[model samples]
Target: MSEHHEHRHPHGHEEHTQDVRAHRGHGPGRRFARWRHRLRHAVTPHTHDSSDKVDGALESSARGMRALWVSLAVLGVTAAAQAGIVVLSGSVALLGDTVHNAADALTAVPLGVAFVLGRRAASRRFTYGYGRAEDLAGIVIVLTIAASAVFAGWTAVNRLLDPRDMDHVGVVAAAAVVGFLGNEWVARYRIRVGRRIGSAALVADGLHARTDGFTSLAVLLSAAGAAIGWRYADPIVGLLITAAILLVLRDAAGEVFRRVMDAVDPALLGRAEDALRRVRGVREVGELRMRWIGHRLRAEVALVVDADLTVRQAHDIAVDAEHALLHAVPKLTAALVHADPAPAADGPDPHLALAHHMTA
Candidate 1:
């Protein structure tokens, strides 16, 4: 067993050193172009592993916190503005949107707590640290969305049974616009950062915000129908908003469920296997597995090497394979590489006894 725990900083340093050497012979124009390229990658989300300027996990947590705080503030203000309109217009649609916005804003609290907990150092009792807190926060968010939907549906049904004329239709429309603008901005911010850091929780929150925005637009439509003397328009749109919430709830729930189940993208497994197979002296790559602990990744891989090689040689090959993986797989912080001897063609299978014992 040749285990290696790698972080982004060392690889970043190596890349920087190489960049400096490469730039020495190149013109300033080339250097500038390379700088722009790195900047683009830094700002945008992608699958390739690249050198990061800071510690990947910590920096990602920090970014997640920042996103939560900003989104919370924006949604808080938007909901407050809508709340006043709801009181004046007595529009069930506006009321439902406002309530949902408030709930969405409150979701930031749990996610912020999770991000903080994730930064704690690993302890003896919990060797993997508290990264799973983010997934828990995601569950909380999903439940919150569901609760909002239920409340909205109940209120809308009550209003539908007993229709009431709404006031301040124009004002409600303006408030709806405000809600749309605020939520759309928050959605873009949270989703971009979430994808960059690989945080499913944050991305779920972003999707929630996006649906809220569209529901807000539905409020505008409700106001228009109310102006045209349609008695049921307000409650009707409220029900529609509730249905939209349920749809987003499904998506967010699915994402959080996958994270909780330790599911990862199949492409990442392929990338890891390819990286391992490309390593020198590796005859075969076997039993490669990857899992997400929060937004970061860890891997375990088995390698087959020549049976005649010395233990030291085998160890070196494993180390090389691990290094290759660190560079090839994005967000991979650690890998455990186990080397096995290639079995002789006519001899008894070396792993058969161990495998049988394990099964037994």
Candidate 2:
């Protein structure tokens, strides 16, 4: 086989300059670095400029968010009523639902704002854009869920240790039913918003609401049990709800934390790499890396090609490969392809020669 030579084009310098500037502006290539780290950790193969679709999706999300606010308000009022009714009836379970309502109200604020922010254009500072706001908001909601769970658990345990006598069971029972219905409506609205926006945060909020709704049902059942002569059932149900909430808190908090830490789903990376490999002239893919930055998938892939190809040819191949990946991965916001000539299977390492050349 004849050995071929690689030559750099005059415009190569210009392209390198632009790539450097873009990387510098985007925060020290942290996103790219993370992408590389995840790819190195897992090697696998598996798994749109539809702006009109994005716009349509966002519009639907906005409408859902608006409905979410109204539903939350209804839930809050219902919670307040439940609190009064429970206190009058001496029902601790209803009191716990009040705390749940308060958490739901607080999380709704961030979720609504995140939905709007995710659709906004990129600023000079955030070149890749604000799509990650929804992810951050989801993180906030998860943290709140954990905190609320812990507090509720502690309170439930205390109440269980020293049970209180019931007084106005019917009033508290009525309030619990109202709260359950209201939360269910809000939860469904949030779930719809999340599906429309592809927002993990909104989905988390919806799931949180579902948990609360379930909790309310349990409280209602306990109140009914109390009225039917099972005086201890109310506190027992509250304790069980506390335990279930803790488990839910763990899952929500863990997922949100991973997303915030820029954890790329391995399957997504494999799919991207496989797509890039399909491009012609791409001899092999070295370090294929990817990460989620807000709503955009930022990828930095190292492509191996024939060492004999001209610089322009290599550059063109890289560009084509990148475009292919972007088109294939709807979530891909941006990509950086580093073209590296394939090294001989058994030959002198290029690094030593390059280092010597640099010193000379």
**Which candidate's TM-score is highest?**
1
Task: List where candidate 1 sits over 4 angstroms from the true fold.
Answer: 1-54, 84-96, 357-360
- Candidate that would win on lDDT: 1
Assess the local accuracy of residue 77 in candidate 2 as a C-alpha lDDT between 0 and 100: 82
Against the true structure, candidate 1 has what lDDT? 0.78
lDDT of 1 by residue, 101-212 (tens): 8866878888899999998867998798888999998988888778767876887788789977767889989999999999999999998999898899998889878877
- After superposition, the stretches of candidate 2 with alpha carbons farther than 4 Å from their true spots are 1-96, 167-171, 188-196, 344-360
Each prediction's whole-model lDDT (CA): 0.78, 0.67
Which pairs clash in the backbone of model 2?
Answer: 89-168, 132-294
Clashes of each: 0, 2
Residue 318 displacement in candidate 2 (angstroms)? 2.1
Error of 1 at 353 (Å): 3.9
| TM-score, prediction 2 | 0.71
